[model samples]
Structures are given as C-alpha cells and as structure tokens.
Target: MDILKSLGHPEELINLFKFKIGGCRTIMPKLDYESMSESLRTCYQYLNQTSRSFAAVIQALDGELRHAVCIFYLVLRALDTVEDDMSIPLDRKVPMLNDFHTYLYQDEWCFTESQEKDRKVLEDFPTISLEFRNLAREYRDVISDICHRMGVGMAEFLEKKVGSMKEWDQYCHYVAGLVGIGLSQLFSASQLEDPEVGQDTALANSMGLFLQKTNIIRDYLEDTQQGRAFWPKEAWSQFAGRLEDLAHPDKLELALSCLNLLVTDALRHVPDVIAYLSRLQNQSVFNFCAIPQVMAIATLSSCYNNPMVFQGVVKIRKGQAVTLMMEATNMRAVHTIISQYSQEILQKVSVSDPSREKTLHTLALIREKSTLSQSSLQSRTHHLSPMYLSAAMLLAALSWQYLNTTAVQTQGTGDMQG
Candidate 1:
C-alpha cells in the first residue's frame, strides 16, 4: 500500500498512469523459492535502502518472479563488481571467476570455500544462506559465460590482435550484448507481458551497449590511469592522431570534439529504449524499462558540462533522481521529457569548428544517422560501430529529442526573464 501510494503520488510530471501497452501474459511456472534458507527479510531490507525502485518492483512482483529477479540482480552485481575492480589481480581473479561459473552448474561443488577464497570485499555475500543456491549457482554459469566471452575479447584487444573496428564492436557485444539476451530471458520467463510481446532483443542489446559505452567514455581518465583502454586505438589515432596522447591539453579540444560524436552515436538507441518501453505490457516491465532510461538521461545531463566526468565520479543528485522517478510514472511524459533534455544537449555542441572539421564531419555523420534514425525507428542499418556506440547513442538520443522538438514553432512567445 505504501508503494501504491508512492506510485500513485509520484512526484514527476509523467508517472500518473499505469497500463499494459502490449498483450503480455504471465509465465511464472515455479514458486518453490519460498523455501529458501536465507534471511530474505534481511535481503529485502538491504535492497530497500539501496534501491527503492527495485524494492518497489520486488513488492509488486509475484513470489516466484520476485525471488528469481532478486537473485539474478544479486548475482549480476557481484560479477560486475569483479569486472570493475582494478585492485584485483587478473591472474588469480579470472581463474576463480572461471571456476565460479563451473561451480554454479555443478551442484556438487561447495560455495562455502568461495567465501574464504574471495577478496574481503565479497566475503559478506549471502550465497551460503540460500536454498536456491542452485539457481545462484546456475547464474554463476551465466556470469562465467559472459566473462569468458568478454575475456577473449579484452585479451585480443589488449594484445593488439583485434584486426578491425568490426572486431571492436564484436568485443562490446560479447561483454554487454549478452546482458540484453539475459534481460530478455528474464522478461519472457516472468510472463509479465502479453503472450505475443513485440520486444526486439536487438534494441535491448543496443540499449545495453549505450550504457556500457557511456561508462567507457566517461571513465577515459580512470581507465587510462589503470592501464586499461577500452577505446579502440583505431578511433583515437584515426580521429585525434594519437591514442595515448589523449591526456595532453592540446588534444583536449580535438578529443572532446571527437568524443561528442561518440556521445551522439550512443544516443541513437534512445528510440530503441522508447520502442522497448512501448512494447512492455505489464507494470513491472514498464517500471524496469522506465527506470534505466530515466537514469541514463540523468547520467547524460550530469556528464554534459563536467569535463571532470572523465577524471572521476559523475552522478545525478538524489533529489533529481527522485524527480525523474516521479516523472517517469507517466509514460507519455517520459518520452517527451527525455526527448527535450536530449535535444538541449545536442544543441550545446552543434557548431562546426574549422580546425577540427574532420572531427566535426564525423559528428555530422552521427547527426545524420540520428536524423535518419528518427525518421524510421525500425531500421538496423543506422547502427553505429561498437567503440563509438555509447557516444553515438548519447548524441542520437539527445539529437532525436532536439530534432523532434524543432518541428513546431511557438508564436508570440513572451520571455519571462528570471
């Protein structure tokens, strides 16, 4: 009831209604998750404090779907942390992860040793306290598979063995593309939509690519400091002249010019998110889709003016995040709002520079792609290459909003100067 009140009285402009757009149907066939030995109340408590939306979602879901999703998120978060930890030695860590995957599928293996073996940071996991250890264990296999694919890709990249930009895109697909697949499986299994859900897995993959690419771009400083470069050497050299010299103040202008194009490229997927949201036929799915898209928009807004986003943590204010959530309560408003904000961002860097005409030209292509994408939401031919996917998606999403809003002119608009 508290969640219902929060849902009904959401603080934003858009979240006023809830409905199923597609003809989705429920598919939860299992419910033995009730027998889990873990202190679920404690898990629920931790989740509420950390993620109110997730908590709301858990409360809203049926018993079977709730437990499965909770476990899935928990497992994925653990794997993601492992991937992000620069302090961990790859020699010992990668193998352990490989073994963790095997352990998940092989029930005879013990996870009790896992607690002792993992770094102190992961020692507090509730893996040992669950009856559905088997499920977590299976998901461990999922993590392992993802890692294996990413490991091979990263290895080739670092070794300079990747032959082309095509390969680079494939690498992003291995690590982040699979998240889309995993999410789609979860959506289908939850049966929270019309039986004939029109969800497009390709768009979901693009959405994930947009998120991951954003991280790579924003972490330019951090990744470089750690001796890990996710940006393709081909792009850095071809566009900006040198891969390692991106830190030089002289290159900043050209780099940022090139970077803006990448951001634009990433934005191309905004329509994909919109399309996906429009396809969802249930409340839980709608919330899941809406929250991430809102967060993505907010992240873009926070990163817009802050060049230091490359150097360190960049985040939206909690108050602003809550505002986005409140607004997201209305589906129509969410689309309109994101479109507007995204447009404002594109307008910031739309001007052409003579010195970096080549860079600007690249962005021009991105702008064109965005325009074309806006013209047809169903076309895959407009997809940007992988390394630039985040930048492209960001710019595209923003540009789409900008272009869409530009179609109408306000007559006799009186300006109120504050």
Candidate 2:
C-alpha cells in the first residue's frame, strides 16, 4: 500500500508515482488470506518486514506457489545470515552452515550465528521451518536441496579464500545459482515455467551469477568494512595490493580500476541471462525474472566508471527501477534495457583502461546477443509524454477491472496493462 514515505527526493517521488500508476496490477495483487494457514500468515508477515520489495513479487505470484516461494526465500535468508556474520568464528560457523538443512525438522531450533542485525530472523527459524515442513513434498525437496548445497558451498568457501575468478563463480553458484535452480524446480512443479528451461544449468547459473556479481560489485565498501572479501583475489590483486585498497581515498584511481575490472567480469554472464530468459514461457515468471535482470544492467551502467563503489553504495535510480519493474515483461524489453546499459558502459571504457578489451568484448557480446537492432531499441524505448503514460495507466486500471488483461507495451501511445 502506502510505500511513498521512503521517497524524499524528487526523482524517487516521481518514480514512485509512475510505478504506482503503471505497475499497480503487478505490484498490488489480491492476497489470498483465506487460503493461507495460520503459520503461513505469520510467515508472509515476516517476509514483508524483512524484504518489502521481494514481498511484492511473492504476493503477486498465484495460489500455493506464493507461499512456497516465500518460505524458500526465508530459508535461504537464514542460511545467508549465518554465513554473513563474521562474528561467528569459523569452527562453529562451518558446522552451522553444514547442519542448517537438518534444523528444518527440529522445531524451535535457533542459532545465534549472525550479528544482532539478523537476530530476529534466526530467532524465528522454527516458524519458517514449520511452514517449510507443511509445503508440498516437491516444494520441500527443492528448498531443502538448494539449502543443503548452498550450505556446503558456504562452508567450502569459509575454509579458504576466493583465489581466482573460477572460485568466485563457484562461490556464487553455491549461494545464488542454487537458489535459481531451486526456484526453477519449484516453478516447474507449480507448472508456472517450463521444466526444460529450468534445467539449463549454464543459463540458470548465469542468472544467479549476474545478480550476485552486481551485488558483490556494489557492496565492496560494506563487505570490506565487515572484513569479508568476495571479489576474487586474482582479479583485484591485479589492480591493487589489497582488496580493501580499492576503497582507500588515497588509492581512488586504482580502486576504480579494480571496480571496472570486476564489473566487466560480471558482464560476461549477460548473454546467458538473456538466453535463459528467452526460454521462459510463463508471464508472471518471466516478469519476476526479467525485472531483476533489467535492474542489474541498470545498476552496472551506473556503477561503470563511477567512483562511488569505492566510497559507498551505488544504486540505480528509483525511477529507473520502477520503470523496469513496469516495462520489463518480455525478452525484447529486457534486451533493449541491457543494450542501453551496455552502451552506457561501452562509452565509458577507454582503450587505455586495463580491462578495456575484455569490457569492450563482453559488452559487444551482450549487444550482439540481444538480436535487436539499434533502430529497434530506439523505436522500442521512445515514450509518450509522462502525462500520457499516466493516462494509459489509468485506462489500464479501468481495463483490468473489466477485461482483466491489457497489453501494455513499454513505450508509445496505448491503453496499457500487464
């Protein structure tokens, strides 16, 4: 409902309005409280508190699928909490990570592994476990399997440092790729997405890697301050003496070199994401997947050649995110977004930059893989005036009330709906 209180800036306010108008249908779905069990009702409430944005997506999902996805997310969030908390020494932490899956069956089992920040989620583990235990066996299998694999991966990385880009990819696959794979399995069981498409390991891993790398790239300062380093030593060591050096004010230039290098490396996964998305058949599943990919590209574009990664958090604008959430419904729209951001990054990369060739080559691959011409991208992204878009959204709301479906394209004049 009223999500605007967080918007203090003009850009954020404007984007919030646009999102409310254009994304009302997808963003505001009817909650089936009548069907949710008591435990589920509590779990969904906790989900909203923990992640308001993700709650929007989960609630938008249909039927039992929504509840299943929420529990799966919380289960992983708990695991990640254990892994992220540096205060937990390696000895206790590794076993906690390895045995996390078993805790699902133990009612009221909770561990204070992470810091006080994640204390509530850990404390509430029993509630989440109860909900997970109640899910369909297929859903339970997917969640448990992914959690087990992710825990093992976390434990493995805890024992050693990330040495190379290969290790980096492996770590990301364990924590995030497994989540993508598990979601695909759940989607298949729910009959929301094609099981075959979900089975594409390379593409699914890339999907998770793309997003994870973006977060890693963005969180350099936070992760470093927390005394955790995820950017591969091989990659960052080439640019600076230490990973933390990238955030040093005196080493700003070298820091940016390291930042660009990582961003370029992350760009390698774009084609696989595009390929994976092209195979998706379900509308909600497509929208769910595409929105984040669009945001990732947009964030990468903002992060590229920007010195903010060293200083603090760098993010895509709220308006841009809202626009992507509303418009990124199909593969074509996603491609155009990726292409736009790819060009933004390409323009910033100079021939003299350390990773210039890799950056240029990776971005070019993204552009070529898009299969959309510049003219198509240009034509597709052109928007009617803001007033017109708002009007179309109004017409869309009216249409959804009657016809229950309206085809709202990203740009141009029309009565739009999702």
Q: Which candidate tops lDDT?
A: 2
Instruction: Give the Cα lDDT of each candidate.
Output: 0.51, 0.79
Which regions of candidate 1 are displaced past 4 Å? 1-62, 85-94, 97-99, 106-168, 194-199, 239-244, 302-306, 353-418
Residues 1-418, model 2: lDDT tens digits? 1223323333334445555455457654668777777878888877877776677677777667888899998998888888888788889999999999999989989874457565667888888999999989999988998899999999999989999989999999998888888888888889877778657777888889999999998888899998888999998888778888877788877777778888999999998999888988877778778887888888888888788888878876655566677778888778888888888898899666888998888988987788987787888643568786666555544543333223334342222111
Give the per-residue lDDT of model 1 (tens digit) for 17-90: 11111111121122243665455644544444444545554454553556666655544444444555556566
Per-candidate Cα RMSD to the true structure, in Å, reads 13.5, 7.0
Error of 2 at 201 (Å): 1.6
Worst 10 residues of 2 by lDDT: 409-418
TM-score of 1: 0.64
